[model samples]
Target: MNEITERDLLDFALLTDFESFLKHSMLTLNPGMPFLPNWHIRAIAYQLERVRRGEINRLIINMPPRHLKSITVSVAFPAFVLGHDPRQRIFSISYGSELSLKHARDFRSIVESPWYARAFSQMRLSRSLDDEATTTLKGFRKATSVGGVLTGLGGNMIILDDPQKPVDAQSKVRRDSLNQWFSNTLVSRLDNKETGAIIVVTQRVHMDDLSGHLMGSSDQWEVLSLPAIAEVDEQVPIGDDEFHTRRAGTALHPEHESLETLRGLQKDLGSYDFGAQYQQAPIPEGGATVLRNWLCWYDRPPERTTKTKVLLSIDAASKDGPQNSYSAFSAWQVQDGHYYLLNMERGRYNFPQLRDKALALAQRYEPTLIVIEDASAGIALAQELRSMGRHRVKAVPVERDKETRLFIQTSKFEAGHVHFPKDAPFIPDLLAELLAFPHGKHDDQVDSMSQALAHKFSGYTLDNLH
Candidate 1:
């Protein structure tokens, strides 16, 4: 009778599930180093299983850096798939050829190891045919750089790992080139469209990055988005049988990444890089135009004997089109050289809806001055409100561009004259837009706030106050 060894039991377990295979292979690859299993790793295993089973054709995963994303998706998963069927043709690419080739070597090492051979005895890699980045059993596994030529080569599975580096993410040329290559070249290199799978795994760099472009365009991809810190209570999938319930403000993986470590990372990386790489939002830090860490947070406005002048500033949007600018309304109570932001509302609304929201805010805040930017929709809304004669509505024309207006009000924020509510739900969105000023996708909030500050500080408006 043949001897039944520990290796035999381990091999059987690995073949049973991808998760088991991943854990076992990781141990084999990195001897003596303990495998720290986290929810993200489990989630990745589940997604990889879906890809293996042909349940999902396209998959995009966005997570923070140094989260073992590359190991799980680009390296081990490809090796695991090939272990099942060595004939499978896998094509992997990264921002550079060196990185892609490095991962390819790692995958090749895993498949060629004695443990892997024991687990998958039938699959064999021919030394004569295989190189550092390419493996040939029946078909072949190839790896290349993002812009590298794949003239006649195609793949059963295509893995794109960090197509653009963090520094290159801001370049329009680089971003456009990546998007074009993906759309024109990389996508067309699938061997069998009906059964082939494509996986994109990277941290969000910009609102128009490859991940963003894919997500915005179609619902074809199954996206597994994981931010460093939990923003809200959510039920996150780990594996088919396991699930992780994440609470707001909780660390993604407390064992590997504690709250203190993340906070230190935030301080080290700055707001832009931290938000983009860690939080996966890609909102850059406020520049010279708008100083970072400017606004002070307050639970309530300072108590004063003098009357508080509540002012409602409106920056209206002309149309309710999907891509059109949003209508922003900011209610500020000016008291003793400080502007306390009482409330803020922003949304995409048509003429009637805009009018209704303005009227509602006016009634709720009971503002002494309702300043509306004298633009297309603003002009109409101001006139309608003035005709009602319930509140004082002032229609002020925006003579300067958004940047100029924002620049004028930057001093107020720098001087710590602007304050925001401590626990407001809109605080994150407002701060993100402010911090990413001139670069972020939305600017309506900044425009409205600037107008409010400009109107408040202007000598003429102060002297002519009702």
Candidate 2:
């Protein structure tokens, strides 16, 4: 095609589609760089258009980093929205002042470009700056970092992009404070709550990070979580009624991040970090001792016999409170050199209540042996249970830490020697705790599980296990 015809076609596309506008803005900012197109960017643009059209008000996007998230949502989307409706006000937020300002400047440049004028002939900027822009109409674009002041100010679209840094996510105090700010300060700064839109764009940082906190709260939020690698067959919605059939183990954006590069990052960051940043799941799959996919799930174990060595492992907490850990126990049936988890329970209980529950469970399951970590509530509970000669109890001293114990038994779990009940009520908790080992909020379940494996297979004879 000729240059004028091509230019006319491009300008037409820029006015018609947000995805085309994103590509134009990307090229405008990065002069000589090639714009490698990906389906994820189109998906994000569709969501943003939905927001502009007032179809979606509250949206949460969790995806891997370096996928043009800021360019598309933070910078390009706002300018595109303003091109369509200059009366719309926008606010872009980030974890730091520098990133927020950078996004604002990029948005400003796109709006000020010569081609932008051709696409939106009616739109004109009356006042503009590196971090703020105002149009001829009563609309503006502003930037602010997390915890920045927005008193007496509101926007039609408030965009939160990476609200918490990776280091900040590790600190509960920081995460909680950021969450509180979003709930109290940010959410309140909506020009019109009925029609206003709020979009959060960030990678998964922790279990209780902004995404988790918002999702856990009573407030409703629509989540679009795109992991680096698909764990199972999925029909991910792109835009309109279209869906991308992402098969298992396929990369989300292979042009940007190949499978080889992702695996290298996983190896370097380890499962815990990779799980948060890349997988969009706070727990690792295979990097941790237990792989969720490798999990050997069984409906039930063979009929109990005298030869079946049943062991009960307990990791008890002294008190019952919101901050306190839950007292947990797992009953395993070791048969034919393989371990099958039969019964599991986790609850917050006082000492007397804890003792009664353990005794009752012991009586019910009639385990061959019961093991408890001699720490905190476990020591006293072990003494009480030991005094009751009805159950054979063994209090294993906490010579090593909980992670160390779980680490030592990693091979047995990965070797497919351990099995869990498929349809148990507590299966979700059990899998979540096991996969999140060494990093999750509560390690009580893992502690009890590792204690059981340690006591039963302490001999280190792989032959018996294999």
Among the numbered candidates, top TM-score falls to: 1
Over the stretch 1-466, how does candidate 2's per-residue lDDT look in tens digits? 6457888888899998888888889889999999988878777877788888888899999999998888888999889988989988888999999999989888878988999999998788999877789999978888999988899898888999999998889888998899999988898899788788999999998888999888888466878888897654577778889987777668888988998788777766855787788877787434366666667878768887767888888998877764567889889898877889888898878888898889888888888788887788888887787676677777778888787888888777778888987667566546655788775656888888888887754443322321
Number of clashes recorded per candidate: 0, 0
Could you give candidate 1's per-residue lDDT for residues 1-466 as a string of tens digits?
A: 9999887788888887777787866786688988788777888888888999898989999999888888788888887887787778888889998888778777877887888887888777764223234445665667788888899887788999999998887888888889988999998899887788999999998767899889888899999888887654577787666788876567878888998898777766755777787887776434536766786889988775556788999999888865578899999999888899999889889999999999999889888799988888998888788788788878887798888989888888889999998867667667767887787667999989998998844444533432
The top-ranked prediction according to lDDT is 2
Clashing pairs in 1: none
TM-scores across all candidates?
0.67, 0.65
> After best superposition, candidate 2 residue 56: deviation in angstroms?
0.8
lDDT of 2 at 407: 87
